[model samples]
Target: MSKEIRNDSECSKTDDKDWHQVTSIEQIEAAIKKEFSDESDSRKTVTAEVKNDKANWKIVLKKKNEKAEENFASEAKSLKDKIYHSRFMTTIRAQKAERFLAGAAVVLVLVVALVSVSVSTCYEVLVDGENVCYISSASELDAALKDLKAQADANTNADMTEAVLSTDVEVAAKHKVFVETASESELAEILQEKVSWQVPGAKIVVNNGESVLAFATLTDAQSVLDTLTQNAIAANSGAKVLDTRFYEDVTAEEGNVDAEDILTPEQALAQIAEGKEEVKTHTVVSGESLWSIASDNGTSVSTLNELNPGLREDRIQIGQEIKLNKIEPLINVVVDKVVTVSEAIPYGETVKESSKLMKGETQVVTKGVEGSKDVTYQISEYNGTTLEKVTLSEVVTKEPVNKVVNKGTATVATSSRSSSGSSSGVFSWPSKGTISSPYGKRGRGFHTGIDIANKKGTPVSAAAGGKVTSAGWSGGYGYCIIVDHGNGMKTRYAHLSKILVSVGDSVSRGEKIGEVGSTGNSTGPHLHFEVIVNGSTKNPINYLK
Candidate 1:
């Protein structure tokens, strides 16, 4: 029988099924071929055909029960189980790796924090086996120590010939966490305060008791004493030194001393010479005299003069520095010596009576000549001052000649009237004028003469008959003339406008020798007159007639 069948796109029962029905075997084969066209499909299928009367046919589909399908399903199920197991294992491993990385990060952060808080490398300085300070590095500590030593060497008060620290210093590296560190400058300051220096030195002890000076060495101290002795000896060069010694009981002790106390040779000598007493001085002010200065300071003018040698009482001006105290050396060097010196012997004079001349007139018969002699003296000097001098012997090398003079015994008539109507005494008035300034304490100094005021060109006469000894420009006396009378008496006429007499010219009493005028230290037209007796100044008014 022939059957006719058709495939439906959608049928109520076949639409929900995966199989389709066909009419012929070729059609059924085509349907099977079409359904299994994809070779990758593992689905198994079973086909069945149903025929009814009047040529009606239909194919039905059913699941095939094949071993291959069963094996495939079993294999697929096993493979799916394996895949799920692999995924689960991978997920677990990833989670474990993430957890380990997180733990590692935490450990790394902990390590970094520990490293930040750990002790850092530094240097520790020790002085005399005791810790002094901490610094940043060893090199820095070394530099600081060197700088401290340099500072000690540069100190002027210390003799640093072989400078060394009093205390032992050391540096070491150390790890410190929470400690204070010092900078280079601070470290140097710390070392300076903690350290001291010592040097080989000598102490000069006075009177074998107290130390007076300190030197770098014993040789230096001895040299100072030697120099002082040499200086004292040099002042008296030609003398033969008999003995030399120190007045003070001085001794030098050699030992180690503080560096600051040590001094150079020069410094030690100055200290010994300056002594222990503080020198005092006074500055002269306006209207102040040496007497007033001495009285106010509780001292004598003679003491001031002795303290300050070459100090003139009248020459002291404003702002002159006058020493009130004397400078006495701590040590006095006593030097004893013998000296021989040549001296001049003065000649003597003899008078012979004569009746042929006037009573005041005299004539020289023979000129006197000076003689020389060698004198030996024993001199004891203390610090350049001669403390004692004794003449041992004197030998005359030449005898002096005696001067013979004839004295006049005849009397002659003369005028006894002066310009002032006074008696013509031994000395007459030198000039015709009014006395202005007297021969006494005129101001701050002695005048030594009398000032006579008159008009210019007034005649200045010799006080007595004598020979002109000096006639020239004299200091402060101007164009002056001096006449030497007999019997060690002389007269001076100064501040002259003109000098008529020359040296070695003879003049009588009331003879014009010069003209009076203002010259040199004079204020106006005047004649400054003076009388000198045996090289000593006498008041002009006392001798003037």
Candidate 2:
């Protein structure tokens, strides 16, 4: 026992619910042990209540001694061991499953990564800054672009067309994920940028059916044609173009890159004019000239002239031959035009008679000469050949000279003149020189008689004994004389300066009739003689005997 404790309320009044008094220390220790008997509880505590409204409430526990700590640690270790032992097989199976799941997840991750890398490796094709298609191999993309370029080049051969064309294609590898491999055909379709132009265009023609050039559009072709025609017109006044044509032709190809071949207008025109050329021989007809022969043989007159330098326009004879080179163009550049030209005007003559001269004898007192005048003519021509001509105006540049003829009135003695038809069928040479110009074609016109060269005052002789019919000035053959013999025999002497016979006068054989001289249309002094029978002229050599 310790000591007794009393509350203030106890001194005032006693109550039946009073607290029990603590008697000894042994009792307190026993009570404490009983309260803390359970060892599983971590806390070992003791509680006390004090009386009335001012009761002291408190809870306290003793600190664990050495043995107590050891016991607690032992109990924890034992519980851990029991739990582990109870689920030993389950724990082992769970650990095995976890390992397997982790390994499978790592393998799946690796597979996914590999697939991603493979899908990312791809090729991209671009055309003119636009993404065209995707491919698997970089080589494939490059090959496709190359193939397109090759096709384009093949389509555009340099000679076939003019315009040069190309395609802009690019290829590159793109790193991507889950990209599908593109189909070859699909990729080609996507990559194709079909561009079209005149690669193999139609030809333009200039001369008749002659190819002139090639162009892309109809408009371009027409433009070339018009330009050529206009330029020719500008260079040559009144120029006419013949047989021009323009056409189109298409050579389209189904490919990525396309090219065209076009030609220049000049080249095409040259091609159309190709033809064969050769030399040929021709015989002159009765009326054929150099110009006509050239036109027939498709050659120029200059070429014919070169081949036959001796052929003359005015002196061409019958049955003459010539050589020429013939060149025929496939396309005939036949042009036509209208033009104006100038020509000469021949002068006229007037005859005046004088009574002082003899009746049959006539002399040219005044010599007549030609004059000049400008005659303007409107002419239509084809290829320089005159087709039509009309006189527009005529202007005289020089005046004409009029010829005057005098007739002598002197008469010969009757005894001197022999009887008409004195020697029958007898003839003599009319002039002294040999025959210079033969009958038929001579100068500008036909020569009706033979010409004999002699001096100016040479004696003229009669071909036969006959009576003089008449003697006077004659056209072309000035101062002409005609004689009539027995039956139908006659003789004529022309281009005489003096006449010895008159009308109704009889002349003997070998009698002089006139003197030779250059008269109207005569180039020089000569004698023109002819023999006639029954009003028909004959060669003088056959009659002279």
Candidate 3:
């Protein structure tokens, strides 16, 4: 019996050693299972002592009641299940929190995008710090201002150097939820009515300190004066100019003026040269002459002649409209000059007694010749008209030759009497009439011949025995006849109704040539007679006998 008891104690020692060798939880569980399977002793108990660290563990075996051991195993399995459930729940909660944060960020971005789309930005225009209008864009406002300025410049008559706005204007950007913007046209219209434009100009002031004309600049005003002075100098082209100046004290004053009041240089010059005069007209009454009309209108006959060209003093009708504007220059240009001219010296006549011809007959011995002399005169003119003239000196260049003629002293028989009547002296009267118009200066023109009034179809005769040089129609002198006598002497009889003589015919003194009539610029039946010597016309009275 003693040997058996010692063997059982040794077996117990081996089991304790096996329990200390277990390192893993599986091995510990397997050992516990094996110990529990052996139900030979129901009171046998197994106890395990676990260390506090994961790397090292110690299990201590002890005997205990079967119910207590079963209860500890159940409790250990429940603790392990609780620990796994706690770790899984912690991981799930962290993932859900991360998704929630991402969703919130997306919603915030959408909200901000919607608000930005509704609100917009625009530009506001202000004048004098007062809001005038709103525009959609800044560029549109700029374009509108430019167009308004150009329109203002175009409306002005004078040149606009620069366009200035009377009020201060500005543009600024503004942010708004709702804004009413103006169109381009509307913006321009508003600005035009609200803004005032100012321009710089100049005025032309006369001696009386009154402004006669206005111009865009001072240079334009000066140009008008310079042109007026230049025209005065140019009038006396060939004369030596002494001095030229304006008659009035003209000056330029700079200031602001109305744009419509400005005048061009050409217009100003015309106004200055032609003084302000309202032209008038006069209707001639019955039995009214040009002289009477001129006297009644506070004017002169010369002025009437100047106004109406081709007007005959003796040919005016009963109902003729005559222009009565006698223009007087606003400024007179006076010029003084010394001029030399050549003048003709008429030759004298000489008579000698001879017996070579019949009684009351004459024959030429020597032809006459004219002389020339240089005459200098001091002259002063106002507005191209002679105001004063004085003779300075006269020098004879060539001497004249007197004409010599032979007169018959013997008498002729009746049968041998010349058909050409006995010629008396050098010339005779061509026609019997009363002198109407004398040969001299007549109303702005020189009368080259004298007019003789008579009844129509009256007898006309040759003044001297000579050949007819010209006959038929002549300009201004109708149905004219010219007789060429010897020694550079000729005679003309105009306004004839009939011609009884032909060209190249040798006519004697008092020979019938033509009949008087009213023709070719003549108002009545008259004879326009002229005497010419050496291609120059002389006073007919001086040579007519």
Candidate 4:
């Protein structure tokens, strides 16, 4: 008879059944035989089929069982043994279990003992804000209080009523005291109320006390006030005190309170309380200085110094604030006339004496003194302003003298040069030359004179008729000639190769004074000329024409 066989997929089994079935090879093999056999003979052959199934199942089961056995043996062993053992894990596991339970029991007993033990606590007592630390052994809060009082001193002024104990803190060691420190303000309040009696105002105003009697006299008051102001007291306040008291005995009339008696303690306090002074602004008049402004305001230099510390040492600028200790208002003084003088007045002439004199014309030419007119002035200032007629004298004469001169007719002599002061009038330049250099600074240096570079040895003529003051070698100005042309005017000719005039000799406008040459301080042959007006060098072009 023929038979048909079914595969494992033909069965309706869950994963758990499949896994259980895999665990038993005999039951699986039996199920396979029953499901596949069809006849009696085949049924008999089922045994044979079972035997083959068993052989095939045995190989598969052997692989699965080998892995399971190795894993189970490892799990059942002690952690140490699993790391070290090859197999036979049951004995190691039992031994490991015994050790684990023994350690757990020992730890459990220790924990129970610690949890059941009773511990002693310590506390600090504060009586009236005073900390009193005490060490004691007590279980209850009330018993702890009893132990604290017994530990502290009874004679002390500490009251137990309304006392406060610190938190129930456990004793760290067998016998240890907890400490609390008293606060600063609490201690200060205690000292203030109970320690000592303080006398009011017994302490000196300044710690290293100063003296009032050291300033004994009124002079002493002035000295003290001066010292105080310099040391930082307001200067005006110091000046007020000094001005009131400094000359007390000398200035005070016999009866009432002298200036010395004015500055009492009350007055000094009042002065100090008024820290700043009244700043007085004043418009500066012409010719007014800081010292003058201070004086006009009836205040001293020191008060002005205090007012404007910005300008510590310099003169006060116009329209500045100048504080004043002018206890009384200053009286304004009015002047009826204002005359401005440019030149210095003679010894006998003053503003008063010169006030009545008038601008008179020349009468007798008694002194014949030369006087200047058309003087520049700021006279237009007081025109509409309040001023009387301000007259100024033309001249002041006390003595007079006269002289006579004899003049002869021009002698009939041709080309005869004489030192006659006939040409007293102004003269003109005798010759002309191209101006080579100007009377000023030349390249890299000062020239001091005009340079007229003419032909070498050209006759240099005088620019004006004058008496020769010098005619000689004058250092860098070799063979130079100088002429004083009267009326504080003079002329010079320098770098000359030849000089035709001698000192004290008179020359005409056309006369030859020297010959131009490259004599001294000359790059080339050139006549260096100069014009002096009133002892000062003036531009020669100004007088050339």
Ranking by lDDT: 1, 3, 2, 4
Best by TM-score, which number?
Answer: 1
Candidate 1 C-alpha lDDT tens digits along 1-545: 22212222232321112232333334433333343333233333333222221221222232343534554454334322332233322353455543433322111000000012233466889999999888877888768767766776787466676777788888888754334689777887888788878777787788976556767778887888889888878877898989888878988788766777777778877877787788999999999999999999999999999888999987999998999986778888888999999999999999999865434557789999999999999988786577899999999999999999987664322333457856535677888879899889967899988898999999998777778889999988989998877667778888899999899998766778889988888789999888887788787665655
User: Which tens-of-lDDT digit does each residue in 1-545 have in candidate 2?
Assistant: 11212211223221111112222223333333332232233321122211111121112222233434444454434322332232322343445543433322111010011121122367777666677667889788656555655555565433323433354666677754334567876665555544333344445443433323445445545554565445434443643333222222312222221234453455544543344355468888987887888899888888877778876888777677777754444333223333333455455555555544333445667787767777655544332345556676778877777666664443322221235733232356787886779867766887667899988889898765567888989897799899876566667888899988899887755678889888767888899987676777765554454
lDDT of 3 by residue, 1-545 (tens): 00001111122221444555554444444444433332223332333333222322223344344455654465445433332233222342445433433332211000000012233467889988989999989999778777866766677556566645666888898754235689888998888777665568787877666436778888888888777667766776765555655545667778776555677787777776676566699999998999899999989999889889999988899889999985655444555666678999999999998865434457889999999999888777666567778898999999999999987554322121235644223456788889889998989999888988899998999876667899999978989999877567778999999989888887766779999998788989999988877778777766565
lDDT of 1 at 46: 30
lDDT, model 4: 0.43
Q: Give the TM-score of candidate 2.
A: 0.31
What's model 2's lDDT at 530?
Answer: 78
Poorest stretch of ten by lDDT in candidate 3: 106-115
Candidate 4 has which clashing residue pairs, if any? Answer: none
The TM-score between candidate 4 and the true structure equals 0.23
Say which prediction, candidate 1 or candidate 2, comes out ahead on lDDT: 1
Q: All candidates' TM-scores?
A: 0.44, 0.31, 0.38, 0.23
Candidate 1 contains a number of clashing pairs equal to: 0
Score each candidate by Cα lDDT.
0.70, 0.53, 0.67, 0.43
Best by lDDT: 1
